[model samples]
Target: MFRVVTPKNDQEFEKYFAFRWQYLRQPWNFPPGSEKDEYEQVAEHRMIVNSEGEVVACGRVHMNTAEEAQIRHIAVHSAYHRRGLGQMMLGALEAVARDQGAIRAVTNSREISIPFFSSCGFVIEREAPTELGLLKRQQMVKKLTDLSSLVLHPKWCTELQKTWSETIPITEHMGIKLHQYTGKTLETRASLNKNINVHGTMFAGSIFSLATLTGWGMIFLQLKEKQLEGDIVLGDGDIHYHKPITMRPRAKCNIESLSGKFSILESNKKCKITLQVNILDDDTPVAEFKGVYWILPGKEASDAKRT
Candidate 1:
């Protein structure tokens, strides 16, 4: 397995800088110090180390706006290329940007690396000047959280939003909105001002609520994708607060882990699954939610029996 983290000591950072130079600059005949740029000090950086404690990959991201961040200097050691280390480092950097309240990520990718970047969900926005002796670059961007493309149907999206607003009146008050339902993951956002407490930060209760609903929505979307109908409910759950959320908080739940639980439903007509939801602020995990959810085939189906 690979471990990713920000370099905390001089030795680790030296290795990180060396790895970048080896992969990105040295091959192009650039000097040693050319791997870094003006953003190093202010940017969020991530280093991935192998089991031997050698830094294998590195990348950096810095805020361009409250809702946007730019990624730069992504490099992976030649020895580890094509092994997915670069994508892992990119994901870590994107997570950092998302926790920082950025809803989008931008990067200028070298032409040789375009396919790799595309595999990680970045799309070319425009082509720009070739730099450092004909290294072609393309301006690319990835939406951190947006529903327009993910939502399968406009009417369904509208109805889901309406249902949440009416059934859970507090959702409307807190300005909670469904951001996307990509079948694999479900995401929602809540306005900071509406959910803020006397401390002028997101309330713990609001965070829990958002996480709970996001998890439930994941199952709901999965049912729709399979052309199946189900009533989803949270049976038991817990939330952990790790950091304070200062901006509009986003909650996301990945349903892949529950694939086995869904298979059980096909055989038994109902299944209970456990899912985890995460709340992010600025690229850091502020809260975590673990929940047990029950799904039944129809309104008339009995509540799921614990097994």
Candidate 2:
């Protein structure tokens, strides 16, 4: 269980501020008070406390414009790395940004942290030069809302959830949840408790299933967008386990490669399209899945039934 909280009082704020300084500033030999700045009073601060009541992660988000916010001082105790606490804090900060009507969240991420930020839906805007020119940093941005308004209806996502829960019993057993689906991306998540292995990491099979279903979900929405009814099935698939997922498992499918496949299906009645899905633990890829899917149009299915 992780708790994201804003320091409710001075005592909590001290712990939160101290954690940030210890992990981020002290290691760099920055002065004691360097961890804080003038923005402390205006920025929204958040931290994650372990069940033991120790602050393990901290970050801040400040609105830079009516539609944009900047995230800074994202730090997690080294002992808490890879546990998804940083990602949890990011989500909390992004939630604050959204509530403030900000459409975009920007941050200057350390080079080592780029993958984590990317996994959280941030894209690299540019690389910035540091003071010493020895270390690399990046300007990253994450879209807080569907600015293009390409989100599908809630009914479709709800129905898709029902279809998986009922038709795929293991999806229900794994506790899979639909996180989001936009114009070209489909995201899903599974609880670690339901899918954990003896090694205390997420089971590989669960990761593959999440990836496969995310790709299928993308095709499902694609069919709806084209106003075509089809039966989508996995024709074949290959998965590479990059690392053991120790946190909540999430999968994403981006559809840039999905373009023009519809033309093949329109001409052939059935088409096999390949999609790549990534399983990430807070933007770190734990597994990669490439699945070839077969989409059979309604007319093609009826014709086969008559044969």
Candidate 3:
């Protein structure tokens, strides 16, 4: 549970000002009592608080007619700095700007804060003055276009969730029904090996299959959502049993990040994509598999998509 706060009253707004005084002004030795000015009247201030009811981070934005705005007074308590609360607050400000019809959001960042802004996908535009005597502040902005990639239509995500739930148990029972199990990319499992004396280790085959399945699931779902249909298949795969696995298995696929190449199938044609699977023990990767998938096309893929 997380809450993004925008101070709408005198007390919270003053707390907003105090945050800069405590984290920025006091440490940087800025001109006394001049750290914050009359901007609170027109600016939209945001804060994030912990469950203990203490404000841990704050930021302010002056909405200058939706299309453009300036962000200011960003600060986080020393104890809570690295937890990304400040970044989260900035995200909220960007949302508000969008709600106000802004197609882009901008910020003026201090030198120390430039890397942080860059990591968040902002581009530097110009330099400006700061309270600490002509500090070369950087101006940056990010267009709201990327926002569209995030909207999931809810129904599609829910369907994907259901597919994951259904597939896990089926894959776990794979060898029980068919001696040959298949998968997509990275996978990790515990004690799928017949050699129990190996101290609870998983078999390479099982781990490989699980990873392939996971990647196949993601690609299958994503393509289906786009109205793209195919028989997504694992034509060939390789496994590298890195070290040993002694815990219950978990797995993942890496199509989203890997560049490589893949193809889509239609009708009865065969199209393929390579899937890399990683098997892990309690979140630490232990074994791996690379799976080559062939899209079988038509009914098989479409039926799976519907399910």
Which candidate gets the maximum TM-score versus the true structure?
A: 1
Candidate 1: stretches off by over 4 Å: 1-33, 41-71, 74-107, 115-127, 139-159, 180-185, 243-248, 255-259, 299-307
- Stretches > 4 Å off in candidate 3: 148-307
Rank all candidate structures by their lDDT, best first, as comma-separated numbers.
2, 1, 3
Q: What is the C-alpha RMSD of each candidate to the true structure, in Å?
A: 5.9, 12.3, 15.7
TM-score-superior candidate, 2 or 3: 2
Per-residue lDDT for 1-307 in model 1, tens only? 3556678779878888988888888888999998887778888878877658888888889998999999988888778776656656676677678778999989888878889878767899998677665688999998988544334454666777887887778888888888655444456888998888888889898898898888877776666667666667778989889899996598866553453356656665767878788788744568778889878764335544332
Sorted on TM-score, best first, the list reads 1, 2, 3
Q: Name the better of 1 and 2 by lDDT.
A: 2
Candidate 1 lDDT trough over 10 residues, lowest sum: 298-307
Give the local distance difference test score of model 2.
0.78
CA error at residue 250 for candidate 3, angstroms:
32
